[model samples]
Target: MASSEESFLARRIDAEAFPLAVVDVLALAAVLTIGVINHNGVEYLSTNTVGWLLTLVPFLVGWAVAGPLVGAYSAGAAESAKAAVPLAVRAWIPGSIIGFALRASPLFSGGFQWTFGVVVLLTGGVSLAVFRWLFFKLRG
Candidate 1:
C-alpha cells in the first residue's frame, strides 16, 4: 500500500501529465486542419462546416493511439525523438491511407494523391517534433 506522501507525489505526476494531453489534442486539430485544406483547398474554409465535423473521429483515434506511445502525455519523459517518431508515424500512416482512399471515393470526388498524403505525413511528424520540443522547454 502507498503512503500519503507517495499518493501526493503520484497526483503531482498525474497533474504534470495533463500538458501532454493538451498537446495531443492540439496536434490532432492541426492535422485535421491540414486534411481539410488538402481535401477541399482554401474553399473549404468558405463553405461546409460538415467537413470539419467529419474529421473529428479520426483525429481522436489517432491522438489516443499515438499520444501515449509518443509520450505526448508524459512531457519530457519520452525515451527520445528517435523512439517517438516511429510510433507517431505508425499511428498516422493507416489513418492517412484511409483518408486518401475516402478522398478518392466517388462519394466525395475530391482527388487524393501523393501531395495530400505527404502533407498529412509532414503534419504528423512536425506535430510530434514541436510537442516534444515544447515539453522539454516547459518541463526540462
Candidate 2:
C-alpha cells in the first residue's frame, strides 16, 4: 500500500478496530460465560473450553472482518452515541446472522441451538453499540 494509505490503515486498525473488537469479544464472552456458569457450573466452562471457544471465536473474527467492510468503524462515521450506536448495530447484524447459520450447520458438532443465537444477537448487538458509545466518550 502507499504510505498514506498504510498509515491510515495502521492508525485506524490499532486505535479503533482492535479496541472495538476487544470490547465486543469480552462482552460476548462475559455474558455467555455467566449463563454457562449458572446453568452448567464453573467446571463446565473449564471442561468445555474448546467447545466454548469454537462457539465464541467466530463472532470476533467475523466482526474483525466485516466491521471494516461495512464501515462499522470508519473515519467518516460519527463518534457519538446517537450516531455510533446505530452504525454498530448495522455492522453486527449481518455477521451475527451468518454466525447463527454456521452454528446451526450440521457440520458443527454441538448442533443448532436457537436460544444461543438469540442470546448472541441480543448480547453482541448491545455490546457493539456500547463499544461505539464508549469509544466516542473516550475520544472526547
Q: Estimate each model's TM-score.
A: 0.54, 0.71
- Backbone clashes in candidate 1 total 0
Candidate 1 residue lDDT tens string, 1-140: 99997764453334455655576567767767776777678677668767675555544665565455434444333544554445455656665565556666664545666875787667866775676556556665
Judging by lDDT against the true structure, name the best candidate: 2
Q: For residues 6-74, what per-residue lDDT tens digits would candidate 2 score against the true structure?
A: 765553443434456556667667765676677678898789888767766566666666666566666
Give the C-alpha lDDT of model 2. 0.67
Clashing pairs in 1: none
* CA lDDT of every candidate: 0.59, 0.67
Instruction: Give candidate 2 misplaced runs (Cα > 4 Å).
Output: 1-17
Candidate 1 lDDT for residue 14 = 42
